[model samples]
Target: MNTQPTHRPVALCALIFAFLITTAAADKPTNVVLILSDDQAWTDYGFMGHPDIKTPHLDQLARESAVFRRGYVPTALCRPSLVTLLTGHYASTHGVTGNDPSPKYAPRDSEVYNQRRAKLISYLDRFETVPEALGKLGYLSHQSGKLWEGSYQNCGFTHGMTRGFPEKGGRHGDDGLKIGREGMQPINEFLDLVKEEDKPFFIWYAPFLPHTPHNPPQRLMDKYSSPDRPITVAKYYAMCDWFDETCGQLLGMIDDKGMRDNTLVVYVTDNGWIQDPKKNGYAPRSKQTPYEGGIRTPIMYRLPGKIKPTERTELVSSIDIVPTILAAAGASIPRDLPGLNLMPNLTSGDPIERDTIYGESFAHDIADVDDPEASLLFRWAIQGNYKLLLTYDGEVNRYQSTHPRTEKRPQLFDLIADPTEQTNIAAEHPDIVKRLANKINAWYPVKKRKVLTTFQ
Candidate 1:
């Protein structure tokens, strides 16, 4: 009908309404769900192209998220790496190296061991954690699985099941570590509470699956275990699948709640675990050693609407995760934190800036609780497809390292060319070694470059 006059006004009103809705949606508070896998191998995921592993959920997540294949953690050990993730500081910067001091403390000295463990737990009080930061802005946060930072309250989790207090036998997560292995009830309950409360939320789902106690469910074990397969390998493989299922349960909870679009899920392993070829144990190079397997992990950030899904080749670090989450949540990030805010890069689909990432292998116990540099067994730096590892002769609190250098020379690997790290081309390229060594020392200076154990 004769509607020319009405059409323009109606269109204008519709545009205004759409703009308001978009603006409101954009300004809505964001929630964060950080999935830190514990003691998992960098190569064990189907997404990472592992032949034996069947991590369908993680694979799907990788497809839908911005995946960085070259992601790394600063330390190979669990406690320190977890601390770094919490504080957005390296083990050295945070001054909490290794899991326990028993390796350094006197043998049979249970008294000293207990004391040192308590000291390490209390040490985290000095730094501001991610949860505490978000909680201040009224974000409800939950902690489950592998929480070494004292009690959940000690780490600023408003709600958590684990009691990490060392005195109460809460070393490295206690009952909290049972989250994934048992069920994701605590996490799902926390999610329910957050929804009911109508508040922004943060979740730390750092489960201890595929870690130790590699006792997978019977069906998972049946799939991997057989007379031909090594028992240890089968169990470990089964554990990986179990962990993947646990991850699916958690993600499914999010989807069931209809909060997937607004929630940001960040994934990274605390450190790599290489199952020993012969035994039910981890190999040196894979776990506590300064090798590709120790430091290498995939970093994924998924926010369906905000960040596009793309596989990124550029080197990214675990250090960047906290800053990225904070940015996504519209929270103010600490200026002094070293990690780059990867949100802009992920959203714009731009190449991540810069090269060098640092790592250290340290005593299972602190060499000196106050000195991170002294505690280090090895210091490494990665840049432009090259990785250099250096060992120093002495630090005041240094102890004998199980993964000591046998040859007193720098070990350099071209990670791009040799992903498995089968060959060390350090002799072939001394200049590259020198450059990377210099970078490592610049970040964490080496007092003496004697390469203590002549490790090759």
Candidate 2:
């Protein structure tokens, strides 16, 4: 009887301690899932005022989330865009200016050596990413599909489901399965794997639909047959629907694991679609250009503890994402980050004051095409509604009477008045044009390489 009493007291104490530990863990750990869509146009989604795109899952997610109406990306293309998103740095610093010039596609060993001098530079893996930073805080980090600028795995992801899109000998095709097949596999697997584990986890899902090939499932492809819309519009709509289906599937898994309330679900696009001017009837420039259609993206925040179901028009860029995620999880924002923690805007009911947003790019055609090295310099800066595009098409020698060909280009736009970017108001608002030009020149130093231009 004496021995039994001693054992009972010890058992009660152990049980009490176990309960306290579990409660503490639950309070601190919060799962974060960032779903990144590839090159999706703003108007392609039904929620964003699209005429006829079936995005039920996206619509449902947005209905219960805070939407950022004026979200933008730092660059128009993939490699630079993803780098800026992870590091919160602009292209000039990150150095991933163009697509991956994979050596596998080199015509010959000598060709690789010859092209090395002119090869586009990519961002190194040393720059810390949100996932890696979260891992430092003892959070499990996992990513699938389109992780970073290059194959170097220094971004600090604990696990990767997919390396990226399926590339077979540099051949390009319209296979939807090839695009998102691997990136999504881990998302589905994690949904099931997390049923027992209560530890906080971070997962990134980048779907490759609606990007280029425009190849969606046949079932979704059958939904749109409007001849009035662009021929590619039907295919584009199909990709959007298919992407939404994946979102629904991921959400279902969250619900099944009973992690919806404790998880933060963020939906955003890598960049806007490469719209064709003749068909899209919206913008003149495509993805490789510094236009709103290429840079402006959609951002959806879904966290009951943080976000209110409302739309905010304040301009926010991709660089702000890392800080925002850290803030959401009660983690500290790193001192080196250029972005501000957005959790206050989401949770405190106070609006964030942002008057200016910046976007930049180097010539994209350099790597893929036989373009002149002199034309590879370009940049832009936007403040409020004013925008200035600076194109550096080689240097102009006074003796040769050479100058930038696009110097004849126009600037200045009242985004509120002409959101479509149709008319050039630079001549009418010379003051605004000069002001914007001066700001751009002040913000970015003029580069005098093989080419250079300063609009101011």
State each model's C-alpha RMSD to the native. Answer: 2.8, 6.8
| Model 1: CA > 4 A from native | 1-18, 103-112, 394-402, 448-456
Lowest lDDT 10-mer window, candidate 2? Answer: 395-404
TM-score against native, each model: 0.93, 0.80
Candidate 2 regions exceeding 4 Å error are 1-26, 101-122, 148-152, 164-184, 227-230, 274-284, 365-377, 394-410, 449-456
- Please list the C-alpha lDDT of all candidates, in the order they appear: 0.83, 0.65
Q: Estimate the lDDT of model 1.
A: 0.83
Model 2, 316-411: lDDT tens per residue?
777788888888777778787766677788777687776677766655423432332333445566677766665655322221111224544545
lDDT winner: 1
Candidate 2 structure lDDT: 0.65
